[model samples]
Target: MIETTPGIIISFVLYLIFMLLIGWIFYRRTQNLSDYILGGRGLNTWVTSMSAQASDMSGWLLLGLPGYAYIAGLESIWIAVGLAVGTYFNWRFIAQRLRKYTQIAGNSLTLPDYFENRFRANSKILRIVSALFILIFFLIYTASGFVAGAKLFNTVFGLSYIGALSIGVLVIIAYTFLGGFMAVSWTDFFQGMLMFIAILVVPLIAIGTMGGIDSTAASINAKNSELLNALTQIDGTTISAISIISL
Candidate 1:
């Protein structure tokens, strides 16, 4: 947990203000259901890419990955490698085909709509089932983000858990209510950039603070020799190279 300082609090407040301002700015543009739902399907490649990445990752990139790496050391690299390969394949193969298919199939805007249209299903059951599943999963997904936000706030500001959670929820609801899709996309782009900067800067800072890579490596090896190796024994169990790759 980072120590709570005036500068950190000010900066966070300013960020929230900027996000709300963006919502206000985009609110006028969101005139109808389609615009609110899909940004009118008019996003450019960069916005689309960043927004997709941000939405997909949410707090996972900031919190979950770092936490996993801290605990698992080099073994965590396998998770990163797998994700990179999967993301590449998804972008290269699935994205274009999905976009084209969605456009051809009655201009479907939502996932449930797309599924129903794609199958040409006469029954409303498919849509209902899809919507129910989506609602359930999405609630779980959203709760994770809220929990991450609350923990972050509590750690940084020493706020009560409920207070932090309420703040997180309110801020999300406010911006989302003001401007639906566009606000979310634009904020996501900003957040993606912030995450990229943090990922790059934090490691460099940590390495420097620890007196460079050599010193850090020595400390890590002293603590747990296996942490220095991507595969093999960490404590007593030998993790095979094949198992590492499979991970």
Candidate 2:
């Protein structure tokens, strides 16, 4: 049976309460559409960077990436490399230009709005198509996050699936319904810091507990030496470097 201690329950409850408090606090300050949409465009460099990174990573960084790495071994490193390169170019080249263009294009609030304004398009078709695609993809993305959260809660607390799912949805809705963009951004910043710490600390602890890198590598190789190979055949066909990057 999975153990769910009282201390863990208490700590989780307190964390939820704190998050709700943050939502309430920001809700009071959210007075207009601008505040609701983009935090009135007043975010500092640190908050903007961390929040963007946090929102981008979300549960995928915690769950999906690790699962992929576990299954694919060193080949999974290509995903990290591709993401790092893409992110760097996005921030370095596109972000500032897009921000400035959006502001200049009648102070557009959303992607569809920006697209309409940027191209000086008068047709409603572009906006309709864009909105439809966004809605479809965002629903898929949001559902994945909810599923990840439910799995996490169920594993940690041994809660029923539906019960854990409800809690996950409630926490998300609470903050989003209460405070909108500012609350999301602030919470994202905090979550990002927590994620960074976890990424560093957990691996260090695991490495130490396993006696070190050499021992860990030896054990992995003992099980299957193919896992140690960066490029290897799967089911008779060689896995291409390009395919790994694409994955």
Candidate 3:
């Protein structure tokens, strides 16, 4: 959990306002189902890609990965490397092809609809099955996201867990219900920028606070020298090949 400050709180309040404002703006523009779902296929490449990659990751990248790194040292990089590779391949091949195909098939609004159309399935079985799987998986996934959000809010705002959770859920629900895909994409684009900046800048700030690279390394070395080694865990165990493969 992040420690809160006045600056952090102010920044977050502004961000929330911006997101809600975006939803309200888009809500007025949304007149038809297509506009609500796909933004009439009008999103530029930047918005699409930012939203795609940003939405791909959730609490795991921010919270879980950091925790893993603290526990496993540099061995946590296995997950990072895997995600980097997968994201590249996904961007290089999957995204564009999927977009074009979905448009050609039927301008499908959802994955299940796309699959049903792509396969030319006469029965609704394919769509139904896909929808069920998505529902089951997303129930778990969305719960995790909410949990992450709750923790983040509590950490940064010094709020009670239930209060934080309620605020987070209400903000998300308000925007999503009002503006749909346009709201989501635009907000995600800005949020993605913040995520990237945080990833790049936070460590540098930490290093500075610790006095420099040498001091930082000395601190880590004092605790556990194995943390400097990419293959070793903090507990002095060698990470297995299977562990690497699984990551």
Candidate 3: Cα lDDT at 123: 100
Instruction: State the lDDT at 108 in candidate 2.
Output: 90
lDDT of each residue in 173-215, candidate 2, tens digit only? 9998899888988888888999999999988888788899998
TM-score of 3: 0.93
Tens digits of per-residue lDDT, candidate 3, 69-140, equal 887778888899989899899889898898899988898988998999999999999999999999999989
Give the count of colliding residue pairs in each prediction.
0, 0, 0
Instruction: Please give me the total number of clashing residue pairs in predicted model 1.
Output: 0
What is the C-alpha local distance difference test score of each model? 0.88, 0.86, 0.88
TM accuracy, model 2: 0.95
Candidate achieving higher TM-score, 1 or 3: 1
Clashes of 3: 0
Model 1 lDDT at residue 186: 93
- Higher-ranked by TM-score: 2 or 3: 2
Evaluated at residue 80, the lDDT of candidate 2 is: 85
Inter-residue clash pairs, candidate 3? none
Ranking by lDDT: 3, 1, 2
TM-score of candidate 1 versus the correct structure, residues matched by position: 0.94
